[model samples]
Target: MNEKEALILKLIKEDPFISHFDLAAKADLPGDRVAGYISSLMKQGKIVGRAYVLPEQRQVLCVGGANIDRKIWSKGVLELGTSNPAESSKSCGGVARNIAENLGRLGSGVSVLTAVGEDHEGHWLMEYTRAFADVAPSEILKGHSTGTYTAVLDQEGEMTVALAEMSLYDSITPEFIDRKWSYFASSDFIMLDTNFPADVLNRIIERCRKENIQLCITPVSSPKAKKLPHDLLGVTWLIANKDEAEAISGIKIETEGDFFRAAETIIHKGVEKVVISRGDKGLIYFTEKGEAGVLIPPAISIIDVTGAGDSLVAGIIYAHLNRIQTEDACKIGMACSILTLQSIETVNPILNNQQLLETFKQNFK
Candidate 1:
């Protein structure tokens, strides 16, 4: 997004009903140029529908990756060295992308910032994801294929092996985010994925701190989590799974006591709050006020766990936006996780505010 385009998006976000003439006047651009910018936004999936109707000003900006996920599950006993029959499925998956979709489905105004290829796969991903959240791709490489993750799973729904081809995310550099820095001014919260480069992570962390913007971060994996800068001063929330928490905290989490300690260690590193998701063991959290608690999810059959963590982040962000209590917010997150775990899709299409509340009521309450 260029400076003028970014400006137009901002003006629209502030007032979605603003006329093209008023927008041009406010942006100090020619009427013809303003029209061109709006047209570009529409083509980019940033602006949808006629008369400049877009979801509210992307209150939450999610930055990281958006990619295709292919999963193959063995129907019977696994044979690693030989051919085996398996059922296959594909869906859109990426930490930031999944979370953004989850939020958008739950009626949160959100936007996704990532990089993609300019090929058919990229186009498909953008169009599909745009159905849930506004798409703001940083760069669309002309020749590169979109990033992809292929996983082999056992009949028990556990991942046996996985491979990632996500080099396309490298285009989402610090400089690229710099161009869209204006977007943050109106965003109520910002979420980042660890797929970003180490420098880009620090740049955003520092920028959020300087701007006093509430920031939340979810690590993509243990290795990427380890890339987060130590000075997390501006980070308001850090929601990480067990491996990610351990990687960032340098603590070997074994007993339940370690979860709180790890969260404290992360807080000492400058985060205001930390959540250590322990998978089936539920999660442990620590607030800036020195408060702490652990919540366990109800046992339930799961179909797939591919995007559960991202959905948890989405639920938590939604709760935070609505001023729900921290403990209850965690419950909502767990409920969202439970729902995602039961779905084959990475982002549950049936999820909505009412369903989320119903799920929470049926499980946690």
Candidate 2:
């Protein structure tokens, strides 16, 4: 075998499910070149077995909330404590659900582990979410009420006020996650949002640690963000909004310096990587190994800011799983967020790997 082919084979043997993107990164070669080498190896019968056959099929387990989102768009200027002419719509949403759907749309195999109520909202959520993800009926609760988020948007499509009835997530107890330990242990990556109960989150973190599975976390909200442990042991990636980051790091973010410091505080707590999303201003990220930078997104018209953060998390996870470089991964994340920002829907229906790559090429190149 050629030297490049031999090296690819060694990497495949080490991580049978590693993506060509990851292999290319490790070999410091262009992705297309690596793909050519892999194809040659496969044609020569040097690559075999199910695991090495389809790297894109590697599964990601998303454990957290699944709920219905009710959005109201005002037709005019807002008034306090009074009704106004507005457009109302309901869609399937929740931090974890959005991330999973984005990943699935981007050609990743994704499974959702969350609970929804027996009501119509829950049923609708389950059916809609299943379009992009594998969510077993048993994983959804039968008796409880499905979680719901109600938001009022301004004329600019920015959320002005929001309310959530997410108590149903309590049904996803530690015992429930414990029952699914085997599945968690087998996944290529585990992603979680803070909508889960603190104890349940702790259990999943501990289990991922023991199994050596990569764990990615999003705080979901400033309040629920506090559910994260003070010491973020076992967390491979921690992605949060500015508010959520401040809450977890106990550092107020007012300037670029403060943003880096906040990320540093979280990294010191044992998180391998920290990404703090600063809306409009862009994102600042830091790694435990001292890699840090700010990614400024290309300017784009904003249709709706909802679900942008979820898309960012999904993008980061997608790029990271493919072993893309950290800076480029953040750029991909920015691209995803920009796509969502241009859509009225919480998760843009047209989002996919091809679209993301096109956006990256158009903006970054």
Candidate 3:
């Protein structure tokens, strides 16, 4: 990577979900000209995916929301009076962007098809995403004020109450996405988040089915996690946490057995497979043919729990695209998730096939 390319990469690592125009401004280049440089870097493998720039490789396309996550840290969980004895931070967030960044770090050709605002953070988010992966601006709809989530953290850095402003994406219509259907159709794998409107998701699901693309939909958080489109059966993989699993499938999960049952229910509902995460307890996966699970003991300490699921999805897709068996895929997903929980920000840790296999053997065996 040249100086400019290296600079761009640094900027991307600093902001994985930023836009192209902001990159041009930060890199001090004309907008159109900077876009050309980005394309060139992508062609040269400096940025190797369908994510930030135009499509040139068999990349993963993530369709979801991108947001600026603002967190406020206070004491006593806002119940026992305000005891300020902590820190606060702001970071790039959003399910699709998180997965895209993870895929890029894992050395996958990743791209994102999502929407952000025309405002400052939105521009920064777009530039960041482009720098990290292949984010096609054409697919990113403007005018909609970008979404944001504000969380109040307690002493332990655990979020208490989160106010998410996601209604801006309520207007993502099928007509808007019709323009970028080609990118969506050619992706090796398609990951969806419930952030988009139901109709838009329906259109994408229908299109992906027609194009023979594998779809993975994340219900995201527990509260208000939308159910998979009725036609989503057999066409999409269900990724959800224990809480989300219960909400979408109406299955009560009090133990590991319940988790497996929830996953099985989704699988029987038309999903080929389901991965349900029981944080700290590890993850359990159930596929159409059989059921298996893996437990990678927690890595010493947890710095931040954000983006861990996204990283796991990247690992799963990596295994899937590489034709690795389902069991092995779950292991890879677990390994990657552990690595992300240790890092302060999301990063793609490039591991060659041999390296990943070695890590798998040492960690799991």
Q: Report the C-alpha lDDT of model 3 over 1-365, residue by residue, as the tens digit.
A: 46877777667667766788788889987888777777656544445454453335557888887898787766444655645665667778888888887777667887887778778888888887776687773343466778888877665555577789987788778887776665665567888888877788788788777657788888777764763565566455677888899987778998778888887777777788888887777888888888567554545577666667887777788888888887778788877776766665544345345555665676777
Q: Candidate 2 residues 22-115, lDDT tens each?
A: 8889988999898788766654445543457522333798888888899999999988899899999989999889999999999898988888
**1-365, model 1: which lDDT tens digit per residue?**
78999999989889888998899899998999998998778755467767787734668999898889999999998997899999999888888989999999998988888888898888888889888887863457786789999988888887888898998676566787666675665578999999978888888898889878899999988998988998898798999998999999999999999888899999999998898898888998898888799998998998888888899999999999999878988999999999999988888879998999999999997
After aligning candidate 1 to the native by TM-score, how far in Å is the CA of 360 from where it should be?
A: 0.3
Rate residue 123 of model 3 by lDDT.
82
lDDT of 1: 0.87
What is the alpha-carbon lDDT for the whole of candidate 3? 0.73
> Best candidate per TM-score, number?
1
lDDT of 2: 0.86
Backbone clashes, each candidate = 0, 0, 22
The weakest ten consecutive residues by lDDT in model 1 span: 177-186
TM-score preference between candidates 2 and 3, better one: 2
